[model samples]
Target chain A: MSEVIIPNVTRDDRIGSVFNHLFRIIAESEKLEGKVLWNFQDVHFFHPFFVFPFSLYRYELSNKKNVECKGMNDVVQSYFSTIKFFDFMDLREIGDFNNVLKCYKEKSYTPICRFSLSDKNIERMQSIIKDVILQQIKLPINIESHLSYMLGEFVCNMEEHSQGKYGYIFSQYLKKEKSLYLCLADDGISIYSSYIFKEKHLDKIDEYESSALRLAKAGYSSKDRPEAENRGYGISTNSNLLVKGFGGAFFILSGGAFHREEAENNIFIELPKSIRWNGTIILMKIPLSEAKNVNLYKYMER
Target chain B: MKRNTIKLSTLLGENITSRSSLQILCNILKSNDVIDMSDIVFISRSVADELCYFEESYNIMFVGMSDFTRKMLSLVRKNRNKPRKRQEQDSKFVVCDDIETLLSVVSSI
Candidate 1:
């Protein structure tokens, strides 16, 4: 078995380099002359930025003959399924980030699995997280349900509204650290467009920071079809779950605006300068101890 | 009294009427006394499908129909005519061109 290791790479633009390294691993592994051929167990110290390339590689490998990958966590499985869905819809060749953005702008519904878990995937993840919480964290049933629901709802919005390209599903179950990290990201339209595009009178309103804050309060949607049954509860529910339930932090960066909802009630503080990205990324960290009693259904109900 | 006006557009010169437009004519049948449906320009397959669904969902009577709309409805009826299981009953369809004629039919019923 052949192996390639990328050493001490600390640049975000080194995505191509990591891909090259993985490609070499795949090529060598295929031609190895041993029964117990090339294995990826020796892979060490993958940069967080390597997630996208790794996901793409896994997807390609899954389609190849005589190649099978297993033991992936729920997050990785969802990512794999999303890529497969996009490839099935012939969207894998959408080439370039700009083209992805353009397709979203056109609302083409081309079945591109933009970088986030869909609602279906989120619900599935919630069930898995809830079971882990119940068994490991030993939390009350209600608490377990609450946390799971909130997490699912929060992550689902990344797919429902982003209209951008690519989504990320990152999960780590660290035995030593006794913690779990789950993050979902998408490069799509932002909360600013959620308000600005539908409201013609808000054209002069340039204060995106304030706008994002107001939207987070409750009962807000920028969709033109206001008569539709959109209760605008996602942001508010996320706030309650993160702050009141878990005493956690909820951060949102969209449309050149940033807001952090810390472990407090109804107190949202704004940060200076937006992250200036075309999408949203949510990173959630929960101690395995605290997550034990997280009931997603109860959280969603509340 | 009945009055009808038809507007022609595009080279095909075929009249086009949407399901919503047909609903408007249905409303006219319900309200007005005179029947005139000569103004209908065209009816596409989509409109016919919607009308079939609408007939199933609502209790509506055909007032008046142009020869074109009538023929289209007949074609759909003939195509869908089949003996199926009891659970697979087909939806009803009605075709009418003039609101006044439809109203007269409904009033007579």
Candidate 2:
């Protein structure tokens, strides 16, 4: 049994480095039949996107090695608590943090949810989101419809494309900023590999940048088979709606690539040298004031 | 030919997240001649994208779609027409038997 210290943890999405470290631990503990202490005493910035890869490796590592996470700051603790990330980590200290946003309660404006591939659950999730939108944001029926559709499309992307057992969604309404953050993540195939099987010339797509760009482009999909209609519009359309249509922010992080959209501009962020994400994460931020009554058609044309 | 009109919201029980509902709609479209997308107050782009598959076989018309849905449908249609480079013969990444295998390999990495 050996304890390892993880220091200088920040909101970095370089998941490869973290995984490499954990894999080293697994390799070290291959013969040991004792719990491995994973000390996080110096963890400062824990990004939400880290949750997906962390959840995946945590389960895998727990099979042979008893991995424990220790010493997290209050902010990191609160963020993890809000999304119940600690539950997946097997950290019993989760009760210490108070989550202000609870899902589905009438008084709560935000939802932190984990759902399965059941239709009833999907309906219930959408209803809760719609309720919050109606109460919190002042937008036309059409704009509301667009947002709802975007939510549905992303969730279905999880159901259809993500080969994972479950999906997670967490949203929060920031009072001071008047922005709503919606994050949906799944432990499934990376976007680059999703298209690799179905399309040709994917080799031209550099894993770090072009993978995210290809997903943001309209009519680019890995679901080009005869059984199901191509699902190119799920990410591409939502990207347009969130950024160009509503003046919000949109991001898709998968594997080592990160794509972000702000207003009319879309940027492909290069992944940090030693980072990789095992699944896909979609994060959207909507400023309710700017999203209302905007002409979505103009953006759709783009 | 009898006109078969299906309201997407009503057919989907106002829940757009369910792909089963899309399958139901696609199944119905196979037997009908016309589909009125007019009553659909809202439609997700993925659903709209699926509707384009029937464009060649069915006489699809939008009777009362709101501006947002109309634009979304047009976007799907327009995007469907764009061209792309064919898949390259030589590959660098490991090609898997299915998406499942590919995902498992990624997680193992």
Candidate 3:
């Protein structure tokens, strides 16, 4: 397999950089004497910041070729169209999980298992993961529920917020450390846009920094009906699930800012600097022992 | 129990009945056997789109399809393949013709 390394560069036109790499790989594959299986594997740290434009490029490329592209199954394909794009964004988190798994495997760690979301294969993927976890780890029922619930929350947010631009989800298990790392990402309207949409007069405000701060606060939403019951619960619920329940570290990066939940009080503290990205990315770490404590109101103040 | 039936005419109207009928069809497919497409005399593209979503979700196999249904499917496929073009024709008759054949084919499936 050929590998292409993208050098660390300034964040100007990140989308263009990704597309340039993708197109070059496609072009080079076409020139090969036989059918060349191309994998755009080396590009790393590509947050949801570039997923939208990259997906659009992929869609247009597929149309230009006029042949059905098979790699992106239903969940992935939904990210390209307006109908289901927002709903499918969290699926991108799988990409981040896959990357971490690759890193751990290289260090001689054995991963429990992995799966992908395809239109035809979603059932199979879920079964495989469930079977592996049940037989190997013997995870408790409550722990399993916790994991599933968290996963659902992440995936649901992607669908609701990303507007079908781009999203992925991934998980990795490290045997030696007995820990799991999961990441979800989306290239869509950032917290900045969410805030701006709710407060139109704030349009002139520098969104990148302020959006990050607001996201760290509880009971805050970019939605118009914030006062309505259950309006702004996802982030706060997620934070509670991570800190009090799982005793896990939660990191959220959006609108060029990053925030981490403190382990003791579960307070969301802003990171020193913004992340230099246009969208949202979340990384979560869970230890096996603490996974059992995941609960609904662990992090909620009331 | 006999399958709950909704007439094609009632399904076509722009009212709550249309939405309810479509939703009923979707719910039935979730638990029951394959739908008898042959009995379906007429269906709008909107209905077809909903059916496609159900078919995809359940992984339902289209076993029997009438020629009209096939033609409608083909037309839908063809239309999606290229840009939409305005063709002078009677929309009502076209739907009626396709519905009969497609329903027959679907029932067989």
DockQ of each: 0.01, 0.18, 0.01
Q: For this target, which candidate reaches the highest lDDT against the unseen true structure?
A: 2
Instruction: List, residue by residue over B1-109, the lDDT tens digit for candidate 2.
Output: 6566666666555445545447777777644455555545556666666677666556565566666667767877876655543332221233334334433443443
Q: Give per-residue CA lDDT, model 3, range B6-107, as digits (tens).
A: 333333322111112455456445533454465343332323434555555765544345553445344443333233222221111111123233223222
What is the Å distance of residue A274 in model 3 from its true position? 9.8
Interface C-alpha RMSD after superposing true interface residues, each candidate, one decimal: 29.9, 9.9, 28.1
* Comparison by lDDT, 1 against 2, better one: 2
For each candidate, report what fraction of the true interface contacts it reproduces.
0.00, 0.22, 0.00
The candidate scoring highest on TM-score is 2
Candidate 1 vs 3: which has more TM-score: 3
Q: Compared with the real two-chain complex, what DockQ does model 2 have?
A: 0.18
Per-residue CA lDDT of candidate 2, range A59-143, in tens? 5567666777777778867766655664541211222211222232333234345565544446545555565655554434435
Task: Write one digit per residue (lDDT tens) for candidate 1, span A3-83.
Answer: 333232222221122323433444444443432222333333443334433444444444553443434456545543543
- What docking tier does model 2 reach? incorrect
Highest DockQ scorer: 2
lDDT of each: 0.40, 0.57, 0.41
Error of 2 at A260 (Å): 3.6
Candidate 2 chain A vs. true chain A: TM-score?
0.67
